[model samples]
Target chain A: MTRLLLPQIGVEPPERCDAARNRRLLLDAAALLVSERGVDAVTMDAVACKAGVGKGTVFRRFGSRSGLMLALLDHSERELQQAFMFGPPPLGPGADPVERLIAYGRARIATVEVEGEVRRAAENSPGTRFSAPARAVSVTHVVSLLREAGVEGDHELLACSLLAPLEATLVLHEIRDLGMSTERLEAAWEDLVRRVTRA
Target chain B: MTRLLLPQIGVEPPERCDAARNRRLLLDAAALLVSERGVDAVTMDAVACKAGVGKGTVFRRFGSRSGLMLALLDHSERELQQAFMFGPPPLGPGADPVERLIAYGRARIATVEVEGEVRRAAENSPGTRFSAPARAVSVTHVVSLLREAGVEGDHELLACSLLAPLEATLVLHEIRDLGMSTERLEAAWEDLVRRVTRA
Candidate 1:
């Protein structure tokens, strides 16, 4: 058996173990920079300084500023996917489906500031936004969760409706344009989940 | 007082009576053609023929194919907003809030094919989608209706979630890419509205 690939939404491309670890460090540093000071702060020098590495190493790993952002987005998305798919309860398989749905929205919202710009970049290209392998996985997960929660009526579309508010694009607007907080958004997600799943 | 202009979302730029009527005729013909044969069939000559006007009139009314599509989208959006805000019963001012929401969603679903493309076109410019005056009007209307319906929890965010499934970008994907029917989407919208608003 060999490793699987889900590359359109980007599964980890194979690399040497040390190289992969190094890249993850840089991405983590970049993500932190973005979260702390916004996407504009993700310069090569800043990411290098934060990661305790030379600028040359950062450039060698990602080629340019854009390359670094793309890598960071890819890394973040894959991490979220892994967390809910294979990690522990609530977001993973062990908890009630309703709780898992709530957890999934909360986790996705937490990533909006870091991952939103690139996701918006992809959204600029019309056909690519909805067709990504990652989005498909998310939709399937939510639909299955809705079924498990015993929610009735058009589970697939309802899942889409539930997932829509958690989208990076919409959440970023609510936060940046409307001055909403992450805490408020998370609480709203919980309320929405309960409303949809309640008997 | 002069008529207030919501031009960014196009609350109708000032126009002479005959020109406005002529424009409406061309737009309606184009709308019908697209609904019958899809957006690809919306060429100037075809629109001109459908509306029983000379081709020069079509070109004069809307400079090009893309221009015509944009106007059609604008016209359609305004009509929906008017219908819900001031037109009549279920979709307008007089009906129950829950019934009004269902009507609103059904009305929006009816316009997906023609309007979805231009809406997707605007969405390519990230800031424009959420910030448009027309979208703002729609959001305000939904929030008010939710409040009127006596629903609980995060009315603004919940309204966004309810409206998200009705977005053209997403609905077009369901119809064109996922092979879903319009009737199904409309019914799903009704189901979703009920779930969110149930006592």
Candidate 2:
């Protein structure tokens, strides 16, 4: 999917260069807080303290904790999207479709390990779970790769099937509630990809 | 997968045979309301009126609207479970494992078409989604079938991947929002099963 064609979220006006930089700084601080102490530790005050900015600045930039959380998730999703769409193999342009698909699954599993709480929060609302533009983009990418790999079936539904196990909600349950390790999850995903893509 | 070993839901005291009969009557009324109108139309008053019982009887039996919805879902799940585990061929004992798995997916899609709202409501709650005993039983059944089909490598996760597309929430969205037909979804699912189980 083209970046220019992607849907814009939220109704915020365009930011000046410095304002955009400041927003990134606050989101980075919030992400660091999430990584260091979990999602609950990302209170406005904590993010403000972590970013060395006033609490008022944090609120002014993101509006609320949930807003900040959403922004952080969007930022992370865009980064992954860019890596797969443009960055080097095997997750990007240079590798075979099957290898790229495997890399995509691994990258998604890794992302969930870090941003699971945030992703689950976003998904908790029923309407947003499958309808999010980011989700659509991911599905489109997967479908493209499946077609490129010459799999002769319904690629759209096949992509959905492949992407389902990588969902944050299920992945988090498998890891936190079922106590499966990240490496094990990734290996299982790789196996699934091979099974589907093999002749 | 045995009915006797299945986890029972709710904690009401055992009902006398007559009370059990009354409860079945009430549930049948509720199911009819759901089918004829929609899930939203299955109010307590409507169920009581449909069943030719007092409104108090509906409340006494189900406690609340959500309670009635859960019971209806449980009733439906039990029926499907029985059919797959003990009833006729393809879905039950006397068919090839691959055909049984395909039958299971087709049956689940048909159920969701009828009971999507109730199933989505039950699945919306995070704590209940993956942890429900009914879900566990379904997953175990799929895993067992995959092993029976002689598919190698992470049968448990593969079963999860297969079942994810059949989830009510996602299936509902595909049918309603995306305008995909149930026939199309079932065909795609059959294709998916064949791909995963193909030698």
Q: DockQ for each of the predicted structures, in order?
A: 0.69, 0.75
Q: What i-RMS does each candidate reach, in Å?
A: 1.1, 1.1
Candidate 1 lDDT, tens digit per residue, B78-128? Answer: 888778876787998878999999999999888776666667766656767
- By TM-score, who's the top model here? 2
Share of true Cα-Cα contacts across chains kept by each model: 0.86, 0.80
Tell me chain A's TM-score in each of the predictions: 0.82, 0.91
TM-score of each model, in listed order: 0.83, 0.92
Give a tens-digit lDDT track for model 2, residues B4-86.
Answer: 55444444588899999999999999888877897889999999999999999999988999899989988888888888878
Best by DockQ: 2
> Ten-residue segment with the worst summed lDDT in candidate 2 chain B?
B1-10
After superposition on all C-alphas, the RMSD of every candidate to the true structure, in Å, is 4.7, 2.6
Please report, in order, the local distance difference test score of every candidate based on alpha carbons.
0.82, 0.85
